[model samples]
Structure formats: structure tokens, C-alpha cells
Target: MPIEKFAPISRAACIGGGVIGGGWVARFLLAGIDVRLFDPHPDAERIVAEVLANAERAYGLLTSAPLPRRGRLSFCASVAEAVEGAQWVQESVPERLDLKRRVLAEIDAAAPAEALIGSSTSGLKPTDLQEGLTHPGRLFVAHPYNPVYLLPLVEIVGGAQTVPATVERAKAVLDAIGMKGVVIAREIEAFVGDRLLEALWREALWLIKDDICDVETLDDVIRYSFGLRWAQMGLFQTYRIAGGEAGMRHFLAQFGPCLQWPWTKLTDVVDLDDTLVEKIGAQSDAQAAGLSIRELERIRDENLVGIVQALKAGQSGEGWGAGKLLKEFEQRLWAQAGHTAPPVDMKAPLELVETRVSPAWIDYNGHMTEHRYLQVFGDATDALLRRIGVDLAYVEGGHSYYTVETHLRHLDEAKLGEGLVCTTQILATDEKRLHVFHRLHAGPERREIATGEHMLLHVDTSAGRATPAAAQVLSALDAIAAAHAGLERPAAAGRAIGHKARLATPA
Candidate 1:
């Protein structure tokens, strides 16, 4: 291993606070830097806030190491002011060649020569961008994806005048911001992402122009199949795996011929007729009909939160994908919710439950899904099963609770981020059957979240037949329930499920 000291990263500055600029600020600020943003746009504050909100989800997806809370983010009145105390500067000005050239010169004059300057340019060669600057070699392209805060890829391209040490410095900054810095040893037009996307986009556009496929149909093709695989693994690696027992060599040899096939031209070029553009735009708008971008963004973020949160809860030796990033995410959440840190119960349950609800569980009214009522109740039954010695290991030993039926009722909306708690009660039990009930409540305020009742059958996984809880486990559960005797029976069991119907009871 090479020996090198990891430099300290405490602050960063954004020279262009547009979407990319704001995203860069959030990525660094959330990682605990005093970010100074200088955006000429009037909506800079709102843009930054929105970007930060999206970045939070991405941050969680990227790390699990404990990171400092989001540092002080301030709006600087001028480019010079923003660079005052920054250890690094990410310039994301307009894409015009002149604009980048002018900004790079200004940054070189205003910021310290030792401080690394990174440009969020797609494909503008670093030499061209730094040509007129006093310190041209210190600047390099740190190309990032749209949601720079979440996606880990940062294409680091070098220009003729770029210095090796400066490139390394830029990589260090990318590391601090929680990204996988892929170095493009030489400058290339259109960069990596834009080129790859453009390839696909060109083909899609060709299809549209030729009337071979409509916009929605083309989108559906990607979303239904390749999108799922791409989410977990990209094209090359995915193909390598798909090569199967024969391996990539054989697979590629067989499929390589397709590369020469007359696939529609994507890069060659095509005239984007007004009619086709209108058709695609109209289709896109229709797809998002009655959707508010703000609310849609919220839902999108909420989904990201749930997915990353799930990744963080791996069985063992997991979270390398996002465990470290989650550490930074926790800090940001704490800051937003106005809390100190992720709370750990003083006497946390040795074994309890963490139930879940997916995006589909959300209703149009923006609340706890109606069917989710049943799912929550189902989770409660499992918790009770654990209490009675039917843990996962026990279930593996061929005995489990099988829900025979359920009744559900939902009251009030469970907006995104609403904290939830549930309590399980054993209504009745026998060798063949276990009757259980559970109440799902929202936060400490005791708002009615949802309710569900379930009648379950005890079964042996091996025999797949009715069975009984192990003697020891059943005894422990009976003892625990007796210790809290006289605690109100959850109202759902006594009568039906609802917020008002739920009576005061033991949690």
C-alpha cells in the first residue's frame, strides 16, 4: 500500500449555486463542511434547500461511518467571499466556454493557490477551461451526475496542462464528499455519462423519428427490465455475470456480432422535428399529470430514504454500499429534525421489531396505505411469535404462525417521515391456532395510525402442518403477559380497528 497522509476536509465552496452547484454544496456541507455558496440566481436559497433534501437520501445510500453533521452553509455575496475560507471550490457556472474561462481566472485570483479548484463541467477540456488562468494546472474537471449528492460516480478527467498532484487533490475532495472518483486519464469530448446516455437517448430519438416506437413505449422498455438490473449493477458487470458458466469471453464472442448489427443510429445525428418533440413532451407531461414537482420530489426522496435505510440494516458484514454514507445521513437528519443523534433506547429491546411500509402503501391522499394496515398487523403477529419462542431460527426448525384471516381499519393520514410504533397482543392461543391483535400508532402524540386483527395457525415448516410453540418459549411469553395482567386489551381485539376506537393500553 502507498503511504500518504489523508488531508483534513472541513470546508468547501460553491461558485455556481444552480442545480449542480447546490447539489455540490449539500454533498459537502452534509459531510460537515462550512459551505459558502455564490449563485447569481435569486432562487439560490430555495434551490440549495431542495438540492439538500434530495442529497440527504443519496448521502445515506453512500456511507455508514459516523460523519460530522452538516456544517454551516452560508450564502456568500460574491465569488471572492465564498472562497474566503474554503479548502476547495467547485465551480458550476453556465456551460459557455467564455463563462468557464472567466470563472476559472477569477477563482485562481481569489482563492489560495494551495486550495484545489474543481469544475463541474460535463466535457469542457480542463486546458480550455484553465487556459487564461494564472494557475491553470491546479484546475481539473470533476464531472458529476445530475443528483451529485447521491450517485457515487465522479468522472475525473485530465487535460494537457493538468498536474498529477492536483488531480490527486481533487480525488481527495471527491472522497470527502462520498463519491467514487473514476479518473479519465485523458480528456474526452462529451465525457463518460453524457456519452453513454447520449448513446441510448439517440437510439430512442431515432425510434421516435422513424415512428417505430412511441415515447411511452420506449420508456417502458427500459423501466421494466434493464432498469432493475442497472440499479444493482451496471451494463458491463451485468453482462459479465450474464455470461454464466461459459464466462464473458464465450458470451461476448456469441453476442459480439450484434454490435455490428444495423442498430438505429444514436450518435450519427437526426433532425429533431417539432412534431416529435411536442409528442414526447406531451407524453411526459401526461405521465406526470396532476403531479406537483415538489410533492413528487418528496415521495422520491422518501423512497430513497427507505431503500438506503434498508441497505444499512444488512444481516452481517453489509452496508459497504452505503453504510459509511449513512453516518453522514444521520447527522443531516438530526440537524433537520432538531435532534442530537439517532436515539438508542436506554434499555433497548434485546429482540423487538422494525416494521416496514413501501411506496405503494401510500394512498393518493398521502397517508398510510389501506392494505398496509394488514401488513402492519401481520408484523405484530411475528413479534408476538418471537415473544413465544418462534424466532427465525425456531421457524427454520419447522414451526411458524400462518395468518388465516385479517380485518383492517385505517384512520388519519400517515405522511412521509411520520414516526410509527406498534404493540402486539395475544387474544387467545392453542396448539393449533394463535389469535392475535395489534395497534399501529403514530409518534408520541398517540394519533390513530391504523389497526389490524389476525387469526393465525401454528404450522411446522417441515411437515407443513399445524404445530405448537416450544414448551420453553410458550412459558416465557405466558409469564411476560401475566406480569402485565390487567393492561387494557388493544381495542382492535375488543371491538374493531380505528384511532378513536383504540383505548388506552400497554405499549
Candidate 2:
């Protein structure tokens, strides 16, 4: 097996400033890659700016990894100027074959020979996309989902002239920027993910056309049902688990016969005739009520972030599917933040986590609830682990730290939207044990609101026994412990839960 290495590209060029193109610009810029964009439309710059703003907000809620400084976004006057020195060039013009070929040819002519040229076509074949190009081998389909910055899936398709190296290079770029690059074995129009999407969409249109369900009802049918499952495990794995003890083979045996049933309307697409179009459009308008397209997009992005983060919270072992993808993306964020098990300021505790309280953390009393404090502390602990080199990959290797005990002291309340920071001080450390204290402060004045003392045990997960941590992790822990040895012990440490000393002598 050939191991794939990640190759980071520092600069990217985006041609076309429509929705997909704008999203590409945002993804590249947020990944710390400078972007040179070329789009003749008058509103191109404005559209890209809006997309970038939305991406930044959505990503802020998605992860806390220290992100690199913002990469510069330059709007170039011509395609040649945009791809002049770009390490990667992406063409995201309208879904017209002739237009794409012209734009791609222009990009291929200007981009450096080593630079990979990717088309953001939803369904166009790569062979068609590469036609009339000088270096067709460098061109491939790198289709991404909408709001590309948050979604990690990218379908990579290679044409007849495209070599394995070109496909690998595209994969490297996608992986480096925190995406799941799934290569199609053969070139096909619409690729894989979109084909599945189209099937569902076609079925949905037919159902709505036949008045079987309205827009809101149909959306509810999915969102309130299998949509949740698809966000994590996906269809096959979900059905496999539904097979119970018999597993996938049993599932196929049970449901295999249904494949021949004429139950699905996916065999044909519904014509969008005037009457059907009006009905669908009216139903959609009613579903939207008064929300603008931008508002709707915001809601969609927010929900996606929350759902994906929920999946991330469920990751364990070698996390599968979307949960695994979320974990990997977060790891990339941490790595970009420059966090490592290295010597730091020995004089004071390390401030590991900083975030503002979200509305979801607020309770009926209008302040952050008790359990929210624990969530923050947990995030802080995860940050501490990451700093000590106990990241996702490390834990996946069969070594991890499990919290054996915890004591939380809620001295004050944290209000919604208040800035909170968690400073961690290592109290004690040994080969297999770690003792740490965390202080959670709120607001600009750093008013102390909560504190947590924890005892964690390093365990060899594969052996199901406590074990000494890796040398690098131990060194990092010991360094922090040594630095804090001179500081006064926290009064909250080692405290038992008792209101006061009771006068038990009378009893």
C-alpha cells in the first residue's frame, strides 16, 4: 500500500464568483491559503465577501483550534493574472460545458505546469471539461458541497488524460485543507455524491408534483427522520446496524428482494411544467414564510454546524463516517494553531481555551446553566490533552486519558455571550496519573466564575489497563507541573462536599 502524504498549497486562484466559486474562495482563505479571484461580474467581490463572512461565523461555532492568520484575497482583473503564481486553480463557472471549457483553457494557459486545475462542476464529465486544453492531464473534477468551508466531502474525478499523479495531487490539496477526497474509479457525469442527491431530488419533485406532500411536510419527513441518521452513520451502516446480530449479510438478504419493487419513482424524473412549477414554487414560498434567501442560508449553516458538532462529540475509538471526518478536521485546526508538547511560560498557568457562551447554554434564568460549565471544562481538558500531544491520532493508537474523578466549584454565574477563558495549572504528574486544576473566568475583568479539579489516568485502551503515557506527553505534563510547583495550592482542591461541621455529639 502506498501511503499518501499531505502536500499543502499556499496560494489558490478561483475563477467565477457565483455561489460555488465564492464558497471555494472562502474555503481556501480560511485554510490559510491566499486566494486570487477572477470574475467579471460586477457583484463578484461583494458576493465573495459575504460568503467569506458567513464561513467565518459558521467555522467559529464548529471548532476552537487556533486558526492561522487570515490569508489575503485579491481580486484580479483577468484569468491570467489570477493564476499567474497560484499553486492551485479552481474553475467554478456556471454549469455550461462551453463556458467551463473556455474558462479552464484560460486557466490552464496561465497556471504553472505543476499547479492542479480543478473544475467545480456539479455533474460535467472531466473528459469534457479537459477538452481543448493545452495540459488536459492537469485538469480534474474537484466537486465540493455547498458552503464548502464547513462540509468536508469533495469528489475527485479524473479524465482519460488525467494521470494518477494529478488525482493524487488533487487529493493532497483537499486533504490538507480538511476535506474528505473520495476519488471515483471511473469518470462519470455528476460523480457519485451528487448522483445520489439527484436521485433523491428527482423523487422529491415527483412526489410534490403529484401532491403527495407539500414542501414543509416533505422537509419534515426527512429532517425529523433519517436526516439525523445520515448526518452520522449514513445509509448502509445504519441499515447494517438495523440488521441486529445478523449484520450486513442478513440485512441484504432481508431487503434484497425489495430492489425489484416498483416502489421508488427515481426511475423517471418529473417534468417541471408550468403548473407543477407554480405549485412547487408557491409551496416553497409558503414554507419559507418571510425569510430571505440569506436568512435561510444562515439557518441552514447553523443547523449543520450544530448537528455535525453533535456527531463530533460522539466520536470514539476509530470513529466512523461523518464523526471521523469531523474529528480529523478539528485535528487540522489544532495543528494549525501551533499547539505542541513543548516548554512554555513556567511562571503562570497556561490559558488553553477561550470562547464566548452561546445562547444554547443559557437557561430559563437567563444565565449559563450548571451543566454548561462542565462542557466548557471538558473542552478545556481536551485542549490541554491536545497541547500535550494526545490528539485524535494519538488516542486512535490505543492510548488515551480517562478522567477518573472531578470536582467543580461554581462560585459565580456565567451569562450568555460573556467571554469565558479557562486557564489550566498542572498540580501533579507521574508516569500514569495527572492532577490538574482549571479556572473559568468571565468578562473583560476576568471575574472568576468556576473552577474544576480533575484526576486523570492514562490508560492503554487496547490492553484495558492503566499505563504510563508516552514520553513526550509525560515530559510536557512534568514541565507544566514543575512550573506550578512553586505556586500556592488552590483552596478548592481536595475539598469534600459538606455544608458544615455538624454537632453529632448529641446523637
Native-referenced Cα lDDT, model 1? 0.69
Which residue pairs show collisions in model 2? 123-190
* Candidate 1 C-alpha lDDT tens digits along 87-178: 78899998989988887788889997677788998878887887878877778898887666666678888787888887787776666555
Q: Per-prediction RMSD in angstroms?
A: 9.9, 4.8
Tens digits of per-residue lDDT for model 2, 143-245: 9998788788889999999978888888877877778889999988788898899999999998898889998999999999998888887899999998889
- Name the runs in model 1 displaced over 4 angstroms: 1-8, 54-67, 306-415, 419-507
lDDT of each: 0.69, 0.84
Return the lDDT, model 2, position 299: 81
Task: Compute each candidate's TM-score over C-alphas.
Answer: 0.66, 0.80
Candidate 2 residue-pair clash tally: 1
